[model samples]
Target chain A: MKYRHLVITDPAKLIFGTAPYPVKTRRGLHIGGGQVYSELNFTLPVMSINDQTLPEVYAHYRQITEGALERALQLNSKGVILEFETLLEMTKSPATGVEIVKIMNDICESFYQKHGLASEIRLTPNDLREFERPALQRTSRLLEPMFQLFEQGMLAGGDLLSIESTGGKEVSDEALMMCDIKAVLFSLAVLGVRDMQFLWEKIAALARQHGKIPAGDSACGFANTAMVLAEKKYIPTVFAALVRVISVVRSIVAMEQGAVGPDKDCAYEGPYLKAITGIPISMEGKTAACAHLSPVGNISSACADLWSNESVQNIKLLSGMAPVAYMEQLEYDVRLMNTALKKGAAYSRTLQQLLVESDVYTDAQALVLDPSNVIRISSALIQGDSYVANARNGALEFIEILEETLASGRMTLPEMELSYIPVLREELQSIPDSESDFIEMMLPLLDPSKFIPSEYGL
Target chain B: MNYILSKLLEAVEYGKVDQGSPYPPNLKGMDGAHELTQKALDAGIMPQEILETALIPAMGNVGRKFSENKIFVPQMLMSARAMGASMAHLKPFFASGKIKARGTFVIGTVKGDLHDIGKNLVAMMVEGAGWTIVDLGVDADAESFLEALSNNPGAVVGLSALLTTTMINMGEIVEKIKENAPGTVILVGGAPVSTDFCRKIGADFYSPDPRGAVEFLKQLAS
Candidate 1:
């Protein structure tokens, strides 16, 4: 069984811990194990200082820490996603960097006293990296000791520190990895905690940084480390941490290639296709692929390759940050289909024939008619049209049927499916422009009384 | 006699770039805007007539559809492609002064950000609405914007930023633009930016989608 972790932090003491259950609050809620466990009831007091300044923001940090700890304790959470605003609020006053560090340590000690629970504290390396913004890099360096003190407090108290590597363009993998490893080492040394989880790939280099695992032995080494920690009775508290670390590594690898499907292969499709094609291919799969390929800019090329390939099965296309890029490729495929059909190109008949032959309707019809796997069908229709036009035409007729059904609410999908199957089989058996005939035959049966609206009123 | 042009416009409005474009499948295998535009031109249709009668009306319909949420990004892109295909034939006429672009619109994503989806959409929509666009691309700064403004006096400037961190840069850029070119119209957008934020930054316009930006530009041009 998979277990989910939740962490909560204390502002005054700077200690963090995981809740055994979920938490709820008036401001926000954290759900754990299908129930609300705690509420983040603490509010940041309005600062008397400038709103934009980091110091002013940090002034409210104490309140935030207190609120976080209280909420976590209330929820009995095992882990928590740390909210940065609390720390930002604490730095507002004219407190020296040392003062801030002391306050953080105090917060951590408070957690030890109150709940005696170790916390999984999450932090984004991106956020830390952002503090090194070009304009602030020099000033931040000058103030490094203060930051280090604060870091020390966090390390000493945090049972788990989740770090994210992807921050900005300047945050390279090497840099993020170095930063994460250093932070983890600091946590281990200060807090006597060996459990560290990374949210992105930047932290994967830590084991290597410490010393390379023997060839083909990285996974074994990690597992051994967990076992060693567990034998020391850290397992009950740190297993979730180990899982998080593993998830980060897996997610990073997946991001590099796109999302891993249930098959562990990258999915190259999305959800919009369901609305367009009525097929439910996994959006999660395409998302995985996007996360994998987006950093490298291979999304367009991969899509082009998918479109041009004739023998490829499961022609799932990956996506990018910009939906426009995907749309651009879709547009290109559509244009190619149009050009082939109009010129009566040899491929056009192949496409049209495929559509007529196929059981599925047009990409549009498939999308509208079926929402579950529309994305797959829409992508398939595009690929099919690129390869063969008769198939494309058949797909178009399917779209027409979908539109007609949606517009008039006349025919049951099963009835439509029943009517469409034979025609499709006939067309497939013999390639022809069977769309017009199919549309004509279906028109009489679409007499409103023939179908009942589904629960969604579609 | 201009029924072909009307049909072409309708095709574009519905994102039918040509007979083969599978979007808006209701018109599948029928002549799309691409074919119809070329056909209209081949039959000696005037470039201005194609622009005014076919392209503009078609684009207007698409814009309306977009505002109504009847269509979305993919559909709008198809319409834009169809408009672009038709406009290609009219390019020479614009150069010869037989057709005129309403005005120049300079656009860019604000500094410290590499995101461009929002910027590109605005550029395409504004271009399709018959304005010339000078896209400065992503991670553009105040100096670049100011230079573009100087080069194209009276041109409207638009800024885009998708990140919360980068949105702050927009405030600085807007201030600089106002200092340098007080008369220049500044349009701001992106996920984090709200109308309230736009007002705070002193930008002239704020739009959530491409069509809103295009409409704002059209109103300014007219």
Candidate 2:
């Protein structure tokens, strides 16, 4: 909302590890404007949690943290981000996630003070909305625990706050599978946008109160679901491509509300988010194979401020534990980019182009992620005055890029995927220009019971 | 084929729920599966024929198209809704013992995982294939599956998990189910659940798409 259109209009200027608005974290870790940092996500091995297991769980987290940081130091790392994504079990046990945050922060403090290794922890609580039947996302008491954990985590020294929020995912799940563009728009642009605004408002307020960075939200539940489905070949890649584009507006609402740069890693829509909003983003790519598979493995890091390996468990590997091994992998990836940055701007741009070239032609899901294409789509997005209009414009722009990309022989797509372009184009173009008109047309098509319009404040 | 029966099948295949549903714009302003289904019955078509010849076959084609990537989840859901619309008229006959459904399928998202879109899709596709679905909803543990199985014996249990975090629960759940019902056939699926993981967990089957689950159940039924 600060700026309505594309901020970084020049694709060459939109490289990773830097942004127009950089977020300076506590303990002297300046994100977004420096060399790319490593954000290592580590989870637990298969184990039940209770009072008896709490000690083991605490020991596991300590082992992963010390182990990874020791390896980071061995590589002469600039800094590190340990994303303490709390499990549902942790949240159910009061202050367990918070205590882990305290443990991590103390270790980080020791690392910074003793070894001069700057680091911070991003606390992402489990979104428990899906635990409820029908998931009363807007007004469920079930959701308050998540915010409580966030507040406690920040108080206990969590630096950056983010959530893989699922506000509009109930309807979006169906829309994505059916390849229903209009429903996807309604879910993301309307309901998801409003939910981000509402949820981020609270998060932003909390961040402001605690003097912590309110890192933005991710449409992982929506766009990532589409991406995974596409990767599995259950849905058209074109559909996933469009979902990625449409998701940007919803994620940007966090910035519009108050959250700032360095959006979460799993939001593959981060490049476009960075292009439009000029916020540094944390992106995961090929190394994220430990967590999940994706076609955006290379291109995702093209504009990333923090390069991540998604999440790996605390199991042992030949080299070391999974988290420590992935940390070494991530440090090397960012080291290459930082070396490129150090060489010169011309060399950095070349590296960025190489990253784009490697993945762009391979998958339609990766095509829209090219920085130039991101700027184009962001330009088309700002042409619309409303969220609905912007979403439609963005989706149409994705198809336009695909059509142009295919026509120019820059890429080759399957005939099945190629055949969907015109149909998707027509469907997107058929949407009304105005928000109210679009909503009117969509309401009768969507089941009234699936989504509560009142929750979206429609 | 009867004239009304043909219209009903076309309506169901195209996802026409009623004259009011504004989908598949080509079929606008026409009676959908809801009205045509009742019409076929009133025209003296047997309810079993409508269920078998029209609803079951149309849904089978829908599932096949889905498996072939010719269609997606929305179209299949529409076909399911269309089949649901048609099935409403045949429910009474099914209750009166005039018709019999294929066996039951009990499904749920594994514990600590709250994703249901995948599970729901499989349930809908399986139910569309004319099976009774006992949907345990989300966050279902082994006890819930056992309770549902106790209520519906010979049921095929399908466990779904959207995260690698919760997918491990499938192993525990599968073991618990096998401990009680040694002969139970279990199916596992989700974003992270693969055939290898399914095999490692000792589950009977794993499919990436809902249509594959439908086909597997069809083969099981056969």
Q: Any idea what lDDT model 2 has?
A: 0.86
Model 1 C-alpha lDDT per residue in residues A64-93, reported as the tens digit of each score: 555445544554443222212122223222
Over B1-222, each residue of candidate 2 has an lDDT whose tens digit, in order, gives 888888888998889998899877899999999899888888888888888888888888887887777875767778888888888888899889887888899999998888777798889889989899999888899999999999999999999997766898999999999999889999999876788989998999999878789889999999
Candidate 1 lDDT, tens digit per residue, B9-91?
88888878778777576898899877898899898888888887888877888777656645445456778888877777778
Position A418, candidate 1: lDDT: 38
Off by over 4 Å in 1: A1-52, A60-63, A70-106, A114-118, A127-202, A205-458, B19-29
TM-scores, in order shown?
A: 0.49, 0.91
Candidate number of the best TM-score = 2
lDDT of 1 at A434: 37
Clashing pairs in 2: A178-B74
DockQ of 1: 0.10
Which candidate number has the best lDDT?
Answer: 2
Fraction of the native A-B contacts that model 1 recovers:
0.00
Of candidate 1 chain B, the 10-residue stretch with the lowest lDDT total is B66-75
